[model samples]
Target: MHYRVAVTGLGIVNPFDGEGEPNSGGVTDFFQRITNGQSAVSLYETQDIPRPISVPAVRCAAFRPELRLGKALSTMMERFAQLGVAAAFDAWQDAGLDKEYCQASGMTEASGVAWGTALGGLMAFERGYRDFWQHGRERVPPMSVVLGMNNAAAGHISIQLGLGNSALTYSVACASAATAIGEAFQHIRNGRAKLMVAGGSDATLAYAVVRAWEALKVLSPGDKATAPQACRPFHPERAGLVLGEGAAALVLEDWDHAVARNARIYAEIAGYGANADHMHLVRPDQNGQVAAMNMALNEAGLSPSELGYVNAHGTATREGDPIEIAALRTVFGRHAEQLAVSATKSAHGHLMGATGAVEALLTVLALHYDTLPPTAHLDRVDASCAGVAHVRGTALRGSKVTSALSNSFAFGGSNAVLAFKAVR
Candidate 1:
């Protein structure tokens, strides 16, 4: 017996209200700011390195985990785990799954957590390196191993939520979160679990991580004045991606379980498709992208024309944007021209492993409210990326979006696509 997955709640800890502000208003406020074209990207500078470095980045500067998770719990986890636990708590509360209720209903053994993080505990490791190499220390902290592990977030979340079923983590670069969510959906759909907390978080603003990305020449260059417009997806003068630090999570429950509990359903996860390019280690393959998308549509029992919107994995890189558009053209054919597509990364910046979860949340909200967020800073669409109906400048409201796809294509040839249908 196949089960259906329902997204009952959402949470985020991003720079959605622009830089330096806490996301106090939660997901609704995030949707409002992003759809209004408010960018969180800003000029980031740090003198921690030998030489001063400046670049555009989105940082959740005001995210205080202590205030949300308490001081004792906050101090035990690294930045990524802190962000992940806070977001998970928010999602749990949003789903109406409090500790008392979970204990009363005997949900401990049926619930689980699946999280993603590309650079897990990067900040802690960086700090350890600074202490050892820069300060000439003999050894690092003993707890560094537990705090710096990739599965730390999932482990903490499972413990906090009393989830005894599973605690899985994925580190698939940019598609990590989407893969986690997709796998969790599969687990629930196959009757392996009844409830799952699925999402990702990354806090990789460390000096070394920034320098490594800088070495790739893909970090968008900008000054204070141009920082807000640095990431222009599908634009003629699009530079490249802006790195970000954030977390996002969703509570996915079995459809029947959600209904029985009177939980509010935002959208139904129709299908998830995951595949590999097997063509390049860095460069994306259009054929692979097309196949991944087709697999999702097939699993969802949806025609190409039925997909009303697409949350594109647009990194604003010259080669990547055009190839993604080409794949969409091939998959949707003439209907590609009618598909409402936008890359919300333009406003929130790219959160690496956490980006897929952020974009997935935005896609769910778009379908829930029938409003499509726009690609900020897109003054003129690039000639090669002009085939689709781009949502730009401001949010497109009342489009009656019924079904949508969230695309997350990562390096190393990993591609994951999720299909969502609005609950009528």
Candidate 2:
């Protein structure tokens, strides 16, 4: 027999707030924060990097600057790792019974960490090169390689929280974090383990990475002084998405297990569907995306019409925004209009691997809060595009959506969809 997964606790470290934000911020809070002038995007300041361009990036949740990061943490990994650890513990404590909730959730002291990332510790890698060319390998830090490994975020969280079950990292292009959340949900639902700290973390606003992204010709080429409509998800002017970083963690618990302890239940993770297009490296395929959504709905024991909102993958890229619309048309058909559709990238920019997890949490919060967050900066909807309203300007209120979907499509044609429902 199969079981369901519930989000009992949430810990988010996004650009909108500090790492310790209560998981209680549902759609309204999230939308309000995004619209209220909170931003993670900024013009980077670094030496030798003149006129350093701005990118949608963040360094959220961490041991405060006073905490003193160790040499073990390359500069890149310091705050980034701290963010994961802090957020993980915050969620652990939030899920009722602190260390006591451990056993109730079926988590052994050996509980694992499911972490995701688009690219891990890019700055650490740069440090190694700077030392290699400038100083020499002899002067390079001994722990540089370890710090830059994709698993750094997970390892740090496991060590800080002392969760020992199994700790690993997923690096699936952009879908990495969403995949991590889904896999962790599967682990708890299948009785593989008790509690899992799953989400994504990344800090890629360095000189080297930004310049390379500039070469992609997908980023905004216009003005940096003005925010160039920070991430225009579905609007025609969307040249490409602004890459951002951060980590969002969710605590998954067994149904009967959580109820016995009188724990707070936010929503149920009824279904998760993941697939790859194999058609192209970066280009998304309609059939694959559509299939993934259908699979998630089927697993959720729901029909297309049941989904009230779709947290779109809407990266705002020319090909991406439209392709996702086509896929939605195939899956939701005429009901697509009724489904409140919004792209969070419009507000916080593209968080990459952590994007899906962050957006998933927002959607789950929406179910609990009975409101839909606005997809800002979406002033005009492409006339011929699928009419999901493209949610723009301001937030919407009063919709009790029992079920919803958050779509994440990553590079390498990776696609993932998560189905969530409000706790009854």
Candidate 3:
């Protein structure tokens, strides 16, 4: 936790005007919208099964669902594979790493990738499945299985980035990306690698998947009529969350290496912690979430009051949102009220595996701009978020955020809390 790692450049291929804009759509835009009392969830007319929150899902700010990977990777899984590759390239450029060869050198077999995906290659598999049923093995596509592996996103990232070190994909429901980042941070901090491209990508808006969520009774039902009223995190009338797609990448550098190259520093990786509750799969657990947050705080040698803002894991679900706030209160106590909290999920829907890094990037920016992002659809506090300053409707200015925490709680009780600070 003492070692210093700075975030130099950032690259995002998210939905809402993704990379640069008055409000980059993807996750940040998602959060900002919810904070502004709006919802990106519209009527997804393409798959009209009814329901309002069933709007067209978050398309990548960078790629259309039909976007091809161009040259080498024309495989059926190219959509996901391409997004992961493009996001990595964006991070490289953002970090000012030379495409000719800002080159990642000496990457070992143990070099880390950590691609986070809750659902992998559903789009490809969906078509593949039908083809298999219709055309039989003659046209099943030789790479069907490979593309469908839950680890395809991470594996493709390694191959594209030339990551000779370590490669692994996490499928821990929604908290996948956050877990990956925590691991990537550990690798660099421990002298395992010089830099790591860490993040997640999800392209699973297939009919079957949506049907699964619908069966679980968590998918938003508020089409255009009251879509904004749908994913209202920490708000009273909030129903549930919308689903989205994105791939936000971050370049994690070794502290010494970053300073040696004179790279622009964004924020320091102060602390990280992850834990599993084993309590329940879908239901929320306040204790496990709080424990992870406390562990990160302790690891950072920070007190609850020192945390200026919290990037809450506000999924806007009936169970998850309030449980997240309860965890905050448990960890911050009386200072919970003083701490500002915002739900990126309120806007972005749930990026599943991408939420952690996406929200972590926003937290770093909050420290940089001194303006905490708001929890868009937060009109009235649910009983759980009653005492906390869940920033809503508008952004707060001149916040002295010396430190902040980004929380990611996923299904199966996977929880991760990352503590960050401005690079002084």
Candidate 4:
């Protein structure tokens, strides 16, 4: 018998409230910001770059892990690891599983952690290189290795939360976090665990990191003046994605187990699909995207017409938005025109590896509240993208939205789609 997975809790830290500050108000605050068309993207002065070029990107203004994990533990963690642990702590607490309760219930040994990231500790790695190689420093930070490791976030969460079973990390470019959450759902569905902390985090706001993206020519060219309107997904004059930093975690529990514990269920992970393009590394393949969506719908036992909303992986790049729209049209046919689709990246900016998880949480909120977050700054949809129903201007309300899908396609052609259904 396959166990059903229920989302029991959620925690997130995004640049939604400005720089470095956690969305302390949690999902409620995030939803409000998205619906209000507020954007997190901003023009930041680069310190590591050769010239004084201002790049548009998302940076957290503050991160106060000391409030939750104490100063000692917080100091040991890099930014990404700290974000992961903080999100996990919020999820754990929200799931109603405190230290005493977990000890008594033997939950410490029954659960695990599965996290994701494209670049583990980019800042740490860049700093280590600068200190040891470029600057000819005698020694680097002792904890640099721990901070830069790909598995650091998952490892930190496991150790801090006493999850004894496993601590797995996925690094599939943009698909990382969605795949992590999908695997966590599988762990519960397959009876290997009762609960898990599943999500992704990335803290790659270093000067080198931003410069590297600029070299690829895929970043937005928003100077300090046009930061708010920089990322316009599917819009006629869309430029490119603005990188952001964030961590988002969800508590996935067995449905029956959650009910037994009187836990509040946010939604159900009805289906998940992940695959590779086997095509060009940077160029997206419509066939790959369509296949992933079909796989998810098939696994969910859902027809194309049953899908009410879709959280698009809209990066606002001219090439990406059209390709994504074409794929959606191919998969859903005429029904695609009626689907309430939106890309929150236009507001929150692209969180890279953590993007999938962050958007998944937003998708959950959309389904839970029956409200559709708009694609901010989209004054006019691109002609190629106009065939579909784009939620723009204001949040669409009172829609009978029951099921939705969050799509994530990555650099190396890794694609992941997760299907979520309302519990009611």
Top of the candidates by TM-score: 1
Task: Please provide TM-scores, in order, for all candidate models, with all chains considered together.
Answer: 0.98, 0.89, 0.89, 0.96
Candidate 4: list runs displaced more than 4 Å.
17-23
lDDT for predicted candidate 2 compared with the true structure: 0.74
| Candidate 3: residue 334 Cα off by (Å) | 0.7
- lDDT string for model 2 (1-424, tens) is 6777888888766655533443344334554676443444544444553455655444443325234334444354544565565566667777764645445545555367898888786677788787787666667677677767778889877766667777878899888888998898888778776667888877766667778877887775434454536577787677777877666788887788778778899999999899989899978999999998998899889999888888888877888888899899889889988778888777777776778778887887878777677766777886545567555676566777788899999879888899998886
For residues 1-424, write the lDDT of model 3, one tens digit per residue.
4457677766666665534643334434544543454555554545333543254355554454334344556454545555666666667677777533423444445445767778877766777766776557557667778777777767776766677677877778888888888888878777777777788777656766777787888777765566545567787777777777677777888877789888888888778889998898878798898889988898788988788999888877777777787788888999988889888766667777676777887888788767788887565787866778878878887877889998888888898888888766
Cα lDDT over the full model 1? 0.92
Q: How many backbone clashes does candidate 1 have?
A: 0
- How high is the CA lDDT of each candidate model? 0.92, 0.74, 0.73, 0.87
Prediction 4 TM-score vs. true: 0.96
The numbered model that scores best in lDDT is: 1
After superposing candidate 2 on the true structure, give the runs of residues whose Cα lies further than 4 Å from its correct spot: 18-31, 35-40, 45-51, 54-77, 97-106, 135-137, 222-225
lDDT tens string, model 1, 204-233? 788998999999998899999999999999
lDDT of 4: 0.87
Better of 3 and 4 by TM-score: 4
